[model samples]
Target: MIKENPLVVSVGECGLDYNRNFSTKKQQRYAFREQVKLACELQMPLFLHEREAHKDLLEILDDVTAENLTLPPIVVHCFTGTEEEALTYISRGYFIGFTGTICKRDRGAHLRDLLPKIPLERIMIETDAPFMNFKKGRKSSEPIDVVDVARKIGQVLAIPFEEVAGTTFKTTSSFFRLD
Candidate 1:
């Protein structure tokens, strides 16, 4: 499917989900590995989703990197980890993608506070469509809602929203090598 869709820049939106454990840990691991392999094979960037399975996720990343699988660029989308974890991934040269969920309370706000600390060059914005709704009085998320994420990032960095949008878009395009 991806090979046929030249416009598709990412092979993922995939990873372990131990938070809800919607699937068994073993199953999640299998799925995550499969996607990683797919991304490597296709030479397409990855949009990873990790939740409460950072240990397993990091282990897999370490193993894969050790194997020299020729990993495509990777972005840990909707990052929800501590600053240390964020730094660990950044150190590996992976980009971080923020979502509108970062505007929410508690940990989300913590992410907001941490945003400015992340180099803009290493950050991207996403809406994780059909989820993480952040619109005023809206109940669901859409790709267009990425604008809100950019806005929030702008507020955190004290920059114009347009600058945030433009910079993130450019960063995402370059990371994915999008045409």
Candidate 2:
């Protein structure tokens, strides 16, 4: 569908997720590599997902990018990895997307610790809507909750919310080639 349609903005929310065993590791790797191939073929940005499979995911991406310099941009969506892991991806020149999980008091500590190390230009914030209910009282999250994501990032990075908003907007826009 993406290959046939010009309206398809990016190539995926495709990658490996071992946390829930939704699919076997082999199946995930095959699917992920195939999608990366499609993204490379189409020259569209990638919207990626990764859980406990960073090492394998990185290896696959490395292999894909090794033979092709024209591959589209890649964003590791809803990243919740450690500082070292995040730094590894950053060093490889990929963007990292954050979600409302960073707003949660209990779960966000590690993310907060690592946020400062990520360059503002590479940060992309998301809602992970209908899933991440970051607020204590809210039943579900919506797209508007991206503001809260930025707010939490601002708080952690000790920067103004507006600056976070502006930088993330530019980062996402540029990554997606929205301009």
Candidate 3:
């Protein structure tokens, strides 16, 4: 179905979520593996969701790649992982998607330090909240919240907000091959 739909640019929002564990570990791994295989088979980009399951996720990726299946372009969405995790992903050439979560001081304090470590070209901002209660106090997350995320990145990296916005826009567009 996804391959037939031209509007579906990516096999998105699919990955492991050990923190929630809505599905058993066995179930999550099987489903995640299927999606990974599908993305590789279809040669489509993957917009992934991972929480507290980085190890297993990496293992699955390695397992797939070990089989001589080239992994497709992968973006980890709504990233709220540690600095080490960020570095690990970056080292492997995977894009990290930061949401409004990074705008919050208490929860995202670590991210402030990690932002600079990320290469400018690989950075991407996601304003639309993905099952997250972050940054916006009580107001529901919205697309405009991306501004706050970009501002936080600028503040942390000591770059101008406009620069952050422009850079992330360009990087995101290029990553997804957007026109």
Candidate 4:
């Protein structure tokens, strides 16, 4: 199917989500492992989603590596984790994707503080549209809001918006091989 469709660029939005009860651990583990294997088999990038399950996720990834599987590029999307988690992903040569959650007036402060810890080359921006709305009272968002995410990241990192925009755009393009 992936070979038949040129648009299929990645395998994911896959990972463990222990913070939510939407899926059983066994089920999530099965799906995540299958997707990881698929990404490796297809030589496609991986779009991961981790939440309060980094320990398990890391272990699984480590096992895959131990087995000598050639993992493809990985991006942890909509990340809102501790600084330690960010560093772990960075150390593993994976990219991190930030969403509008980093723009909130209050809840975003911690994320802002961690921005400086991530290299521009390892960072990407996303809106997580209709989900991670950061406006003071807004309950939804759109794709254009990724600009707000980049702008806020600039403010937090003491960089120019244009630089942030350019860096994130280049990082994302490179990761997904958009060009």
Winner on lDDT (1 vs 3): 3
Q: What lDDT tens digits, residue by residue, belong to model 2 across residues 75-170?
A: 999998888999998998899999999988879889988888889889999988988788778889999999999998888888899999999999
Model 4 pairs whose backbones collide: none
lDDT of 4 at 100: 88
Candidate 1 wrongly placed segments (more than 4 Å) = 1-4
lDDT of 4 by residue, 127-167 (tens): 98888877766789899989999998888888899999998
Instruction: List ranges where model 3 is wrong by over 4 Å.
Output: 135-137
Worst 10 residues of 3 by lDDT: 129-138
For residues 31-148, write the lDDT of model 3, one tens digit per residue: 9998898889988888999999999999999998888899988888888899999899999999999988787768788887788899977888986654455654555677777888
Q: What tens digits encode model 1's per-residue C-alpha lDDT throughout 1-179?
A: 77778678788789888888988999989888878878888888888988878789988877776777878888998888888888888888889988888877764877987777789989988888788877779888988888878888888889999898888889977887774
Output the number of the TM-score-best candidate: 4
lDDT of each: 0.84, 0.88, 0.85, 0.88
Q: Which stretches of candidate 2 lie over 4 Å from their true place?
A: 1-6, 67-69
